[model samples]
Target: MTTKKIIQDFYKSEAFINVSEMEPYLHPEFILEWQSSKGFSKLDKQGVLDLTKELSASYVRSKIRILSLVQEKNQVAVRYSHFVKTVENPREEMLLAHFFVIWEVKDDKLYRGYQMSQIS
Candidate 1:
């Protein structure tokens, strides 16, 4: 899948809270990061999916703004802002963060994505 398609599917799933379709775009080792109420935190591949799946349970919306995306061969880097809110906390929080994600694809499926993120 192309980078644009990744963004597209993510947004599309945003509507239905169905991220399974996006699993293909993500590298198996994918890492998703965010700032906790205290400090920065990160999630590895399983962590990312687990978090997304859980959040989708309580959340009705998840938005991502791509600042930039550049991929050279297997590596993909993205800078973005994410807006999220959980069921317990009804207030939405917006985080402007930059991320560097390393990607490796196998069998035409995203195999791994090692990533890091921080507030911008």
Candidate 2:
């Protein structure tokens, strides 16, 4: 599959909501760098998995809206918003974050990414 399609499908995948389903879209060496008002943080493949697991445990429902996604060569830039409600308040869908991320696809999977996000 093309890099663009791979990245887009990854976002729309059930893996986005369920951490256990993430393997197919991730490279073995995947890493993510996050920049937010708090500062910069990084995550390796295992860290990503842990994070998603924690998020899935904490939130009852989740949704994503992809505002724009563009690719050049093996890199993709994505602008998206994520909404979720905590387990404690399942009926209230709140903005989890709005994000801009750049991902590099290698060997047909997401290898690395740099992202900036803001909480709403």
lDDT of 2 by residue, 7-98 (tens): 77887776755876787778999999999878999989888888888888888777788999998999999999988889999999999889
Q: What number of backbone clashes does candidate 1 have, counting pairs of residues 3 or more apart or in separate chains?
A: 3
The deviation in Å at residue 33 for candidate 2 is 1.1
* Cα TM-score per model: 0.58, 0.92
| Cα lDDT computed for each candidate against the true fold | 0.59, 0.88
TM-score of predicted structure 2: 0.92
Pick by TM-score: which candidate is best?
Answer: 2
lDDT tens digits by residue: candidate 1, 3-118: 54554454445632446755655666655555544466666666666666776897656677767776777546666666666666758655535555555555555565555666
lDDT, model 1: 0.59
For all predictions, the C-alpha RMSD in Å is 4.6, 1.3
